[model samples]
Target: MMNFHIHSTWSDGLYTPEIIVREAIKKKMEKIGFADHYQTTKVSSISKKYLKMYLEDIKALRKKYGEIEIYAGIEVDFSPRTNIDELPDFEDFDFVLFEYVQDSLWDGYPLWMLLDLRKRIKPPVILAHNDLSRNFGATDIEAFLRVLEADNIGIELNTNLNYTKLGEFYYRLATPIFERVEEYNIPISIGSDMHENLELLDDVEDALSFIQEMHLEKNLKLFLKEVGERYER
Candidate 1:
């Protein structure tokens, strides 16, 4: 299975990058990624100066352990906590995750702002752990997804407990949006948002189940294709 969202010591997570990689291999995971925090405030995160070193650390692990596909990812807090104005191009990362987009509860920047920022970002971008039903439940679903498709933005099915509502995941709660996602060229990704928990390495099983139940396999493939293109470049 593939889990593209995770955290390690490069940010607020407890385990180091190598440790996370080793545990993922032990769990028989086919693919995984390190998506540590990249915020300016309210949390420990990767600053611009250490960004290159962070990518190199993951690069070394990819070479050391050829058993699994290791990807370098960053989770950008799309809120006031992040310095979006000075954000890097992130051309080196396999994929990018933007959390709290258009989330009023967190005072996140709106979708229009991210669209403007996307012009400068070359890598594939995914919306991380968002409550679409809460953020854009009133907006037209087709229009909302179309904007994402136009900008090449994907949505992440996160399995973190924090995102669950009365035992149902946020993605599950937003069934209306996901039900129609297949019709568009939008990509889909699954992640456990694992942090400080080794046993949760394979917690993405539920997310995988969601993809199959929703018939979003093609969307998943789209994301993999984007990641593969990065290798060719």
Candidate 2:
């Protein structure tokens, strides 16, 4: 098994990077990626100092364990007004998990610009909760779907919290996006997005079952790829 997306003390998560990887090992997780939140919830958070410290922690864990492959990443919040370059450099991590703040997830991406952003972000890119959107107007989700379909970014189906309770950004909003994400050649990632240790295995089975029902195993090749690498040991 592989939990490509996880959290730890790297950010606001409950455990340290070492404990996170250890738990994954206990969960029989062959691969683990500690992608802490780098959100826009606060005007000033996840500072440069913190991010560097987080990355170093992951590296140290990797050195000590050297048993499981650990990917240090961030679940980045893409604010509509967010300047991509100003988002700081994430090239240090294996990839950046691109999610949006429900309030400001951009619904417009010019075809050319979308392609350019894709090119600029190497290593790997994930559009977290790509199908997930705010519950405002139907037009918002429609606009988002259009932009996502046109881009080659990967998508994440966060299973930690029930998005439905978070108002309109949950249930109804992501159904269509999930369908479309599967239709396109874009890949998908199922993440527990767990914040606590006991909550670690939060919704893997259900999330996997959902994807399986949709016959989306192939569409979620990234997780499999990560699993394969981890198990190569």
Candidate 3:
């Protein structure tokens, strides 16, 4: 299994990078990206300074740990786009992941603004999750999806989707967009987005099962082939 989006104690998560990578290696993950969240949206805050140590730690792990492939990345929101440049060499990382969750738990952002942000980001496996706005603003997500498709950004099929009333209904909500992406023959990556160590490997099967039941096997294979290559032993 491979997980490109993950968090550790460097951010709001519950473990250290070493522990996270250790567990990933134990679970036999082929490739994993430790993308801790960084601060964004401050009036004067120019960059995520906290990422310095995290990146260093991950890089050290990359050199020391030889069995698994570790990508040194930080998960930043699709806002505060100014900070992207503040980050050091993009070539150092295998890939990165981000989403459009600016408002409440809705997990979406303005498509036009997203398109604008895409122009600034250098290619590194750009991905967004389920399309739902927090303020309940009903916006057509096609605008952002189209731009992502055009720019060669791949969306993530996160298995940890919300399935309750309070939680945004991601699977059903994502059906149309997922179908649309498939119709366009765009690529996607599957992620556990594991916040904690255990949950890291917990939901891959469930997410795959949901998509399979929904009849997305071909899409799944295509997605795995693109993203899972790094995970192969």
Candidate 4:
């Protein structure tokens, strides 16, 4: 199993990266990533000054623990809390997660703004825990997904409780869009958005089931291919 979205002491999480890595190994996880908050006003985050240290920290853990693939990632709040214009070209990390895109409730920036910013970013980008059904319900599905494919952006199947409604996840609610996603080259990822809980390390079981139910194995493979390329480089 793999979980690409997680938090640690570098941001608002209770445990350190090492702690999370150790627990993941104990759970026999195949892959895990440390996606701490990056320069967001909404939470404790890693700034430019400590970015190198953060990457180095994850790198050291990768060497120390070969049982699981530990990737270095950052979660960027795509809202007023972040200065998108001054954002760095995150070529150093494995992948990036952009939260709250096109969500008015969080004052998130529009999709157009993110598309403009995508040109400067180097790593693979994934939309983090977004409620697509509500956020883009009015927009044309094909056109919206086309825009994402043009930019090579992926979507995350976040199984966090906070994003659930009536015991169904946001991704499950947007089943119609995902049913059509196979036609595009867009990637798909699964994340539990783990924060303070250690037992939730493998909570992505439901997400894995959803991937099979939707036959999105190809999209999942696309994301793994991107990550593999980054590692190969």
- In order, candidate lDDTs are 0.91, 0.61, 0.59, 0.91
Candidate 2 Cα errors over 4 Å, as ranges = 39-45, 80-85, 101-116, 130-150, 166-173, 222-233
Q: What's the TM-score of each model vs. the native?
A: 0.98, 0.74, 0.71, 0.98
Q: Please give the distance, in angstroms, between residue 3's alpha carbon in candidate 2 and its true position after superposition.
A: 2.1
Over all chains combined, what TM-score does candidate 4 have?
Answer: 0.98
What is the full ranking by lDDT, best candidate first?
1, 4, 2, 3
Better of 3 and 4 by TM-score: 4
How many angstroms is residue 93 displaced in model 3 relative to the true structure, after the best TM-score fit? 3.2
Please, what are the lDDT tens digits per residue for candidate 1 over residues 31-130? Answer: 8988999866967999999999999999999899999999889999999888888899998999999999999989999999999999999889999999
Ranking the candidates on TM-score from highest down gives: 4, 1, 2, 3
Kindly list the per-residue Cα lDDT of model 3 for residues 1-233, writing each as its tens digit: 77666777777667888888788888888777776665666222214564566667887888889998777655656554435445444434445566654444433454455455556555355554544333222546576556666765665667665432356445445565555555544555556767655755535665566566655666656654554453332
- Stretches of candidate 3 above 4 Å error? 41-47, 79-91, 101-109, 132-145, 161-169, 210-233
With candidate 2 superimposed using the best TM-score fit, by how many Å does residue 65's alpha carbon deviate from the native? 2.1
**Clashing residue pairs, candidate 3?**
none
lDDT of 4 by residue, 1-233 (tens): 89999999999988999999989989999989889999989999999889999999999999999888988889999998997878988888989999999999999998899999998898899999999998988889999999999999999999999998899999999999998898899999888989999888789999899999998999999998997687666
Candidate 3 has its poorest 10 consecutive residues by lDDT at: 128-137
Tell me the deviation in Å of residue 3 in model 1: 0.8
Candidate 3 colliding pairs, count: 0
